[model samples]
Target: MLKDLAIIDYEFRQILLAVTIDIEHFAKIQLLDKLEQRGEDGYSIVSSFLESNDRCNKDGSVSNYVKTEIDRGKSGCYTNDLVARYPSYDYPVWEFMELIPFGTFNQFVQFVAGKYSDKKLRNSFYRLQSVKSLRNACGHNNCILDDMKSGRPSYQVSYDVKNALRAAGFSETTLKTKMSNERLQQISTALYLHHSSASDGVVAAKGDQLRYIVKRMYRNIEYYEKNDVVKSSFSFFKQVIDAWYFNDD
Candidate 1:
């Protein structure tokens, strides 16, 4: 369980980094510049919102966590020397993306993606929210699989994700039933995001890691055979991994 959680945390970070970098290249304008254009007061409003304690601050800010990350970078705390290249608060979008926390980065991605008209990019933002939740759970050493019962999710599963699972041979009834469980919803969304957005190499590498996880999970399959919740959850994820990553056809 620990190993699986760890892999989800690691792979989500990698995927976030890769996707953020790609967005930097794809947007053509700097993220900060784009962000400033959204408000009359510009950086002040953005900074204050970022620093605010209010939960309704939807614009998100790079002022809190990001500033600390920038300070760490300037102090030679990070192994990546690229961070040290920018010696001031005026970081490029790529540098800023790299330094922010997972939650902040997820916010930035949503903020950035909203600027474009692409439906898929916006949907990916929603998917990342689930991944962020899973990542936080793992980071805090929480038991990710403790709950397998349905009707507890704070939000509905993404339509795109449901479609993908259906295409992978899961019936609509199965998705509607199983995805209602919060843990399954999150874990499956993380898997979907990893498959859809991660780089091919990242996907391949994580695929290898997931395969190992599956093998280890089934090593004592008999132990869980009668535990329908555990058995069904594990089998659902295993099928997803096999269909999305290991399938050649």
Candidate 2:
């Protein structure tokens, strides 16, 4: 379970960072047009980021990204200087994306969807927020499985999980298990996070890695089932593994 969790988290983080870079790049390009339409200024752009949000820091201190931007401004910053500071900040993409004001974030989402027309990507800004929330839970070592005995907050399963399950041959018996019955919510969220920006190579390699894990998990399940052994918590773990049907192709 730990290994699997690490894999998912690692892949998700890579994709999240890639997506964030793309988002920030596109936002800078489209900012002037959006500013004119909304009658805002460059300060609004800077303020809309997470650095400007007081609630973002648990210690009530400004984020390192914000401080870095401030320091650069003291040295006579240019417009491009503001853009350069964003990528260098050592912050999680999850928080970075959320700190953006909703309206501004929405426009960015629209910009990406309209420009790319990539149907595989989620166009809803809210889905990006959901991915961020998922990333936060994984980063904090929270229980991701909905029915697992955990104190972590429960999450609504993404539709992506159901679709993946369908493609993977979800069984009626499997549907009754805790892993599946919980709605495959956590795995689905992980899938969406990866699909949001992962390249074909990364996704394929990760999928192959998961296939090995699934095989091992299935061996354990079969041994327990055949021996009439105690149905341990690992049974739920196996069920979750069975639902992972991701394919790069």
Model 1 residue 22 CA deviation (Å) reads 13
lDDT of 1 by residue, 1-249 (tens): 446534543554454344334333333234445555644233343344344423433567333555555566555656247666655444445445566656666666565565455465567667767776766676656666656766767899999888889989998777888989887887777777667655677678767767766776676667765678777876887898898889343
Superposed by TM-score, candidate 2 places the C-alpha of residue 55 at a distance from the truth, in angstroms, of 9.3
Worst 10 residues of 2 by lDDT: 175-184
**What digit string (tens of lDDT, one per residue) describes model 2 on residues 25-118?**
4444443444455554445343444333334567676554444433444345443454445554443333333344334455445544444463
Off by over 4 Å in 1: 1-69, 72-76, 79-88, 247-249
As a TM-score, model 1 comes out at: 0.69
Weakest 10 consecutive residues, lDDT, candidate 1? 20-29
- RMSD per candidate (Å) reads 7.0, 9.4
Every candidate's lDDT: 0.63, 0.45
- For candidate 2, the lDDT comes to 0.45
Q: What clash count goes with each model? A: 0, 0
